[model samples]
Target: MFNLIKNEWIKIFSRPGTYVMIGLLVLLVIGAGSVMKFAGVSQEPEGDWKQQTQMQIESDKQYLEEMGGSENFQTQYYKQQVAINEYRLANDIEPASGESIWSFVNFNSNFVEIIGLFAIIVAAGIVASEFTWGTIKLLLIRPISRTKILLSKYITVLLFGITLLLTLFLLSTLVGAIFFGGGDGQPHLVYIDGAVEEQNMVFYLIKTYLLKSISITMMATMAFMISAVFRSSSLAIGISLFLLFMGGTATQFISMKYDWAKYSLFANTDLTIYTGAMQPLVDDMTLGFSVTMLIIYFVIFHLLAFIVFKKRDVAA
Candidate 1:
């Protein structure tokens, strides 16, 4: 299996599109950083832009106490007061400001949308590339099992996800160093109470990207399975891409209107969203829980890919 994996690696690396995707990811990270760098948008690392505002609120309340409640602004506290209550209800932890880059890139991740979109491209490209150049026959004729071939392809595709993310992180760090200047790698999630919860940005970024990678892996597995079943890589990719976007909307709708959303693969689309937009998890649902679901989904698709590929006839 290892050798099979290696052989799959060679074939995958040999493709030009693989490197192209890596290059694109490099550009994306650099581009985003460049935008941040050039725009003069230094976000408060304490999560959310209004860390100072939260601080001010605390100060105001303290002042009010000292003044014997002589002055009070209902407007200021009322707006955030409900949010505070909900934060406490949803998470035992007090609502923090967010992250160092919340103001700039907090909602930008939309992991499900990003990873789902990425998966379609990578997944379709995996088998589409083989069939595009008419080399799929050579692929199947090898001594390796068809199931192993698909697994190898899946691995190679996943490596692409890792490489792309690594490039983005490295480029971001470099850009941040060169353009934004060096800052602490430690990421802190600030609460509404003005207390900061520290998270290693590097580690958090790694874990977040891995979650994204897993999402992409599920996508790749699904696409590969489609390719095996359809035997038309282009059709497989096209179909998968179509389904990705559609599944996202459909799944969200189902989650809202029906009670079966949790059962759907698309239901667990966004890891960030699953964590309540990084708000925090109070119930059984968590980033870890979402990842487990993803793993189960990946395994199911993986098995299906192997089963179909092993049994399918080669027509091309």
Candidate 2:
């Protein structure tokens, strides 16, 4: 299995396009960092911390009142923000006053979507390209079982995705440190279960990135499954990319009216909603429910891919 995965990795790196994708990611991060550093983009709020906190609290309270004391998700979110801000003021713990390395890192987390795009592209092509180029027969002629071959390819795709994520995290951290100095030792504050909590900045950032990557990973898995089943890279890439970009929006629209939308892959892909950062799109969607939904989808995707690949006729 190790040797197979190594071979697959070597094949991916042997292509010039792979390097271009990686290089593009690096350039984008650096460009963003440069712009943030030189364009006078203010990462910190202006005015005295106490005044700002008080104003924010007032704003949240007003919004809540305007919500007519409803128990909706947005109402709950604003309440949480109010609580956290009140805690900040009562404890005399001012927020970070200036842009720091951690701030830049958090900003760069938006680029994780781009990473997902690239990973989906790779996943879409990895298996389909073998059949498109008439290399499936070559692979089938080997002594290895079909299941092992497919598993190796899938594992290679996952490893590639992880490599891109780590590269993004490490490169963003380096660029952030170069442009913005080290962190100011402020703990990330959150309001959980009606109580405020302080979390380590570095640990929070790491967890945030990982949670954000969950959607990307699921999309890549879907692309892989499509590639193996259809044996057409273009088709696989098109469908997966479309859903990757639009699935959440469509799901959100549906969720506004239908509670069943909570079972959607896109709805559950965002695990961060469970982390106290935001409210779930649909009520009653818990972390355990989302995880269970994701696992079911994951199993179904792999099953379809393996079953189709195992039975596919390569002799034609």
Best by TM-score: 2
- Local lDDT at 93 for model 1: 39
> What is the C-alpha lDDT profile of model 1 across 1-316, one tens digit per residue?
7776677667666868667766665566567766766765444456543554566556655655566743223333443443454444444434333223432232224333454555566666676566667777898888877767777777766666665555555555565566545433434342333232345545555555555555566666788777666667778778778776787677665655565566677667456443212322222345566667777887777677677767766675
**Weakest 10 consecutive residues, lDDT, candidate 1?**
275-284
The residue-by-residue lDDT of candidate 2 on 262-293, one tens digit each, is 99999999898877788888878889999999
**lDDT per prediction?**
0.58, 0.91
Q: TM per model? A: 0.69, 0.97
Residue 136 lDDT in candidate 2:
84
Model 2 scores a C-alpha lDDT of 0.91
Model 1 global lDDT (CA atoms, 0 to 1): 0.58
